[model samples]
Target chain A: MTTTPTPSRPPVPGPPQDTSPTFVGMPTFHRAARAALDDTQQRRNLHHATRTIRDKRSRAVAELPHWEELRRAGAAAKDEALDHLADYLIRLEERLTAGGATVHWARDAAEANRIVLDIVRAKEAEEVVKVKSMVTQEIELNEALEAAGVNAWETDLAELIVQLGHDRPSHILVPAIHRNRREIRDIFQREMAAVGRPAPKDLTDEPSRLAEAARLHLREKFLRARVGVSGANFAIADTGSLVVVESEGNGRMCLTLPETLISVVGIEKVLPSWDDLGALLQLLPRSSTGERMNPYTTIWSGVHEGDGPQEVHVVLLDNGRTHVLGDRLGRQALRCIRCSACLNVCPVYERTGGHAYGSVYPGPIGAVLNPQLRGTESDIDRSLPWASSLCGACYDACPVGIDIPELLVELRSRVAGDRGRTAESVAMAATTWLFSDPRRLTAAQRATGVAGRLVGDRTIRSVPGLGAWTNARDLPNPPPESFRTWWARERGGGTREGSGR
Target chain B: MLEPRDDVVPSEPRTSGQRVALFATCFNDTLWPETPKATVHLLERLGVSVDFPADQTCCGQMLTNSGYGSSALPLVRRFVDVFGGYDAVVAPSGSCVGSVRVQHRRIAEESDDDSLADRVAELGPRVYELSEFLVDVLGVEDVGASFPHRVTYHPTCHSLRMLRVDDRPLRLLRAVRGIDLVELPEAQECCGFGGTFALKNADISISMGSDKARHVVGTGAEVLVAGDNSCLAHIGGILGRWRTGIRPMHLAEILAATEGTPA
Candidate 1:
């Protein structure tokens, strides 16, 4: 592989520290989401992009008469892979070793980053170009490398914008989906010159010009960087193959041009056979980009003598995936392909954007997946489950049939179980006490009716300590007489319930 | 406003012997009695006798959905105990029936009583949202009701996604005499009244609800109807706040209307 000189910079720092756009200490989903709802420009951007993609995805999915079957098949394959995950992983390691790729096991993000940093150090490389990878973001690999004084340049167009703009990915498939084209143009004009090659001085907000600038800035780095890092869409055990699908060909360059290549893949990404990829390949493109097929799908197995990278290292990362797999109901989240179909259709995500989720994985999937992957100990993780309105839109749109609404409720229960008594919990307890028996409910309703008579049909605009709802929307006063009271007094003859059996 | 119809005359000649119970669903029972009252009027007009089980109160959906599955257990048993014997249990709310059909069994499975689980499963199919009961089980496209006004419908998320009750409400509304039924843009979207979700995540809820309100008002229809009253209350609250001169109505309320009935 061709190599060029590393750009001269300051000396390196010690080990990796957690500096990769940490979502830590974010406010609760309600508070954070409430704040995000005020950004009108960002909301408009999300509205346009999500609506366009959602419509296109629906049309693309509808073209195949057996689309539902394909979805089920995709789900079944992931389920099977997860069921026999240990076997597949062991088989994958053996096959990868035999095929000339070295396999490394990482129990968590720190171990995974250590392995990657060691490889870069062994190569004596100063910088490594990277393909767009969520696992890398999840593990904060770039921040780790940067802390160790190694430059990890992102090559994907959206990723490059996110990196340069110093912004976290808002959507999975479209990372910078929260920014409109004009905003992207501004980011490119203002930020590119500080980091690398300067943008065209008279650059207008044309799409082609922006892409050209990105291409121009990335091409030299691709040819020069001696090391590259990537994450795979699917890792097949039978053939010991890693597949990276992308719309841009930058992934191909990153995979091949670098002499030493390292790939970080989640253990849950393992599929038993290449045969399973057929249905998944169909489902992912249609669900994510609304494409019949991704423009570029690179399937690499270890190394060729002189054709591709001379050395290949694959990191099988557990990174709390096993913790997620242990829960019966929560385990279904492992079936996700990161296609982002749920994000496009979620009304809450459309309004608040993905930052409100406080994780790289945002929208409905993030709400369930983050809590499982990173336990519910953190404020953000605990709040993630309640971010959704239980609309079931995510479940219907999910290609894997994950039943996200079911999982959200399950996670909510898990969160509640972990907490001590609070005002909300006490209120819930009181409600349960009141609702358990019909007589109790009747008594409460009678009291509520007496209160209702005092208020009549007047609206309550705001209530202190209950302003979460009343501050936004007015509430109708309760009716003076409840349905059961009316029924008991008027339809007075028979207790048609068989008197509670 | 909703006085009980003491003059019990079955409008249609046909009558079924199926024992039916009305589950007004706690929210409707307390806040919007007009919905259940209309349901009673509509069902009785179609010659199907209705019964209100005095022991029936809440379906425990609010508890279960609010992450209090254990707290919701007593009501779960209470539901099966009171309505399990009936041939059909009808509710004016889609979300309540949806909870009965889906979430109750989930919570019951965790309760670890195989018998209760089995009974919950058996009862799930018998539970029907108002639109489903009126359209499918009753096998009536036309209830011979008149609603002489322009109306648009918002299919609540539970009815649209969970129950997959596609076009049933539309089919029912289309059959109403003198009714000018207009289509709503993004009608299938949620009104953001996710039970306690409004209280919990209120800003995002209001953001979503206002968009739904904008669409409802943009339709230029006098009434915005939906299967769930909670959603109606939320969207109606926004309409009322904006002084849009439009009001939200439940599907049962519109279906129960007739020439002699008050609008």
Candidate 2:
């Protein structure tokens, strides 16, 4: 019997090549932000959306007299979880297995996608309905599934809008924050049918009508799908439960309707205990959608014989998290609850919108988090650190109290270190050298004053490299003599005349 | 020896017997020497002894914020050495003072120099931005200065967020005789003068500055006043380029004004 030479068991698909957009080739923040600034409609849409949310968030937060206490507890809880992340994760896996769910660990995005793909392919499912999952977006699971001929349907209203428009998410909580109601109507009319059920031809630009169209369009997909994909807001280690907070019922539909359920969660999402949910739940709703309590709070632990998804799978994703945790100062970014409060209040984000950040994550948190998670390896990631004006607004608005400005500064040092020696570095070194000795600084100031004369006026309307400054403002004509010079001659008893005044 | 500029006339006689050292920041010392001079005049007028340590240079904020924390170490050491002898060190610019108070220790710690960190910690509280000194330390809101102009105050982000000198400049401005202190729309927003932020991300910086200039002009104010000249230089540069008929003035210059010397 010629035994068919057993083919080398197809080399277990080594971590499905990470297909997630790393924003690898995107232009620097300055270039991208410039383009974003010129888009007046996007600016207007962002301004309205952010301002509305900012006001609502303020009111929601103010309703709780103990909001600050809640923030402290929430922050402390995350810090504890992060400190003992390995222990908590192990406990979570054990509890999940005990509760009848299959647990898989993915070292990176590629691994995570491969695990999910293997599960779906095993079930012989052609399509999967999805809840709004930032982690899924981070891993680009839908893109992977599509490449493998499995369709992933986004059921959340905003996520559906983004999916239908074939666009990327901008804001963390509201993925379509850059699109106004009219824009949504146009997107629905143009793109809804290509994917699934079409929007009513009579649909107006009114928000309710647009939402209704999305609801009808997504409902068909949610009921027929035998597979569901989700991301958890929090994963409880003690009980092996996953919690999802949402305003709409789409998360509920997707979480319950499918026979085979798969959840791709960040390892950082695991809480040490179920009790930690109270503080996070309270903090998240107010900070994110500006609701005192989310309309839908779904909690599920593995499966029951007759309820929910009978075959449940949990894909624990690492995907750059371990590297982020390695940074002592930067690890604080892990405490983030994906609340877009920082985005709403950030002036930079308000103007440039989320697209400028060039990541699934955007705004102040993205500025720090992306660089750490992705490693300042690309132009976009390197430029993310300088995207802010060191505004502390984000820090104040953060529910978990991440010192975003401090992290931005810290990450900037890393980015600078990677570049070795640029003109800015050389100039900084020279300036520091001049500043090390007061006499040298004084001499430099004298030189600058002499140079000021070459311009012939006390104001310079233009200068090379400082065109950003001179483009809109004028540089003060450098004083003929520096303060030290005036101080030495006049105040310090040196025999020299004050030149100008 | 050269004397104090003829443009500066002491508004009030010195008598309070509080000794203070002037930490004239690098930006003020180089581009706007008049700001520190005004700070000295205002402090001395309130009966405080003001000393200028010749060894003092930059506060190292520019270096630290620009991602050269190590390069800022020598300057941080120089700062502590030059001003550590005094009971209190006052700088005119809120941005510089904010850096000295907030970033100096972090810069030292990041470099793993525990001694420098300790020095920064001990000395940080003693260093005050000008308005902070006038209100928190000296316990004087009104310096009996006179500036008859419709002026609006742009609270620099460092001073507003870092120093928390809210309403101190206003209280001082409110007390100034003949000063029309109008409120600036969105006064707390940054003027986009984030040290090198302007040079590096000039387009965004200009966009932010233009908004500030529009608001300043909308208020019909003759002058835009702020505690930090760095912010003023940015906003003022925009206003100057646009010729909005409004000029940016340092808070110290406004506070130093007297009936005899109109700012």
The lDDT for every candidate, in the order shown, is 0.87, 0.85
Candidate 1 interface RMSD value: 2.2
Least well predicted 10-residue stretch by lDDT in candidate 1 chain B: B1-10
For model 2, give the RMSD to the true fold.
7.7
What candidate 2 gets wrong by more than 4 Å, as runs, is: A1-22, A452-458, A493-501, B1-18
Q: Residue B263 of candidate 2: its Cα lDDT? A: 75
lDDT digits (tens) for residues A132-248 of candidate 1: 999999999999999999999999999999999998899999999998888888999999988788888888778898899999989889999999999999999999999999999
Q: What is the i-RMS of every prediction?
A: 2.2, 3.2
- Candidate 1 per-residue C-alpha lDDT over B1-263 given as tens digits, one digit per residue, 9 for 90 to 100: 12334333335433377899889898898888889999999998888899888777788888888888888888888899989999999999889999999989998999978899999999999999988888778877777677888999999999988888899999989977788898999877778889888878888888889999998888899999899989988999889889887878999999899878855
TM-score of chain A taken by itself, candidate 2:
0.92
Of candidate 2 chain A, the 10-residue stretch with the lowest lDDT total is A10-19
